[model samples]
Target: MDSSSAIHGYVAEFEKAEQLVAATRRTRLAGYRVFDAYSPFPVHGLDEAMGHPRTILPWLVFLGGLAGGVGGYLLQYYPHVIDYPLNVGGRPLNSWPSFIPVTFEMTILGAALVAVFGMIILNGLPQHYHPIFNLERFERASQDRFFLCIETKDPKFNKTETREFLLELGASEVSECEE
Candidate 1:
């Protein structure tokens, strides 16, 4: 199959961050769903402009931490109270206090691991290439300029119309990206 068949859409470059932010807001207002913007640095209020919503990663990490805490406590409880049943110094086999440190450690570990892995999975990491990488101008997206890309998968995306819209929104230049 032709690699270009995986083409996502057109990318528009903006010299100023404000222009890019405004364009993102306009694109979002116009009901474009599958679009993303890139800037050399984080742009204030850009997420709101792009219609990005809060993520559930926090909840995922919380649940992971809870699971880890429960698992860690059980790991200690199972061997001591059920399997081995060894008691020293007349201490109770199900000593909850002894489990606290390990449980807390496991909770933190689980939260950290979930956060790192969840971010990776959610962001689609390990991607070696993208259609936008085909455009030479996009290289500047990390160094100097800002860019807004409207994916072809978007409901309102039309090559000509999207290009025209980006131009109307004050894009310095627009280019088609190929996969």
Candidate 2:
């Protein structure tokens, strides 16, 4: 297929989130890559059931904070002491106590920024369109429905076979999802 030619896959629509969740669990257990899921609200245990790996956002935040803390301390220290030494209250150059508060604040700010940006990138947000959104009934996703989309890129995805598999897994309705 041409690189510009999108390989469309079928979508199995469900009336309830529970049905979709259960189907996703089975599909993952069968070793299929799930493209995404849509739910009205957060569903407890759904991520675990889908076998989603743990997120690295926390680690990224920590590293960012560490770098910020070091940077803030160095910026203050280099300017106040090394670049132009200033004697005040007989305090020694490179005073550790004076730098603590500013360092702490900078660390928190950096971590917060990193956390926000990391989450956005990791979650792939700001998407204007999706194949699943093309389905007529998918408008209920933000209301009372849940959806699981297994992409055509999945190794085991055969149009006919996947539909049959979804149906057997108790999908309320299965319809083709196109992009």
Candidate 3:
């Protein structure tokens, strides 16, 4: 599938987070895959309730940090000791203690950089447009409303059936979301 075409879904708007959560639970129980949720404020337990799997970002961050730490150590050691031996205060050329600060800083920098890039890649950021944005009322999502999107890619998704399902789930109103 084309990368940009991966976000086909219908959006349901709710006035309250609780209603959105309840509707989401019902949809999941009915074996529907919910694409995502949008709310102005953070909604507690949304991830677990939506059954999202644990992300690999932490692992990526760890590996990036480890690489940064090693790189920093080598950069310092190779230049100061191997390339040009520096014996300050009669201390050993390969002094490890002095390298701690640089290693620590690089580790943090690399981990933070990896974390940002990993999250963007994992979540598919930089999306210029989405079908749901075309819906008139959807603009409320960033104000005082909550939204639950059920993607067409879901195994149980059918245009007619899904519309009927949302209507039955106490949706104040239902509208077609098109790309």
Q: Which candidate do you rate higher for lDDT, 1 or 2? A: 1
54 Cα displacement, candidate 2 (Å):
1.5
Badly placed stretches (over 4 Å) of model 3 are 1-8
> Model 2, range 1-179, lDDT digits (tens) per residue?
34313645666667776777788788888878845667889987789778777999999999999998999899899998899988898989889898999999999988999999999989888777666777888898898777777778887777778889878887677777766
lDDT of 3 by residue, 1-179 (tens): 35425546767778888888888888888998747788999898787778888999999999999988998899899999889997789998888998999999999988999999999999889788777787788889889988888887787877778888888878887766666
> Quick one: ranking by lDDT, best first?
1, 3, 2
What TM-score, computed on C-alpha atoms, does each candidate reach?
0.87, 0.85, 0.87
Q: Which ten residues in a row have the lowest lDDT in candidate 3?
A: 1-10
Model 3 TM-score (2 dp): 0.87
Q: Which one is best on lDDT? A: 1
Question: How would you encode candidate 1's per-residue C-alpha lDDT over 1-179 as one tens digit per residue?
Answer: 24435777889999998998889999999989998898999999898897667999999999889988899889899999999998799998899998999999999988889999999999999788777878888889899999999988887887678889989998889888875
Name model 1 segments beyond 4 Å from true: 1-7
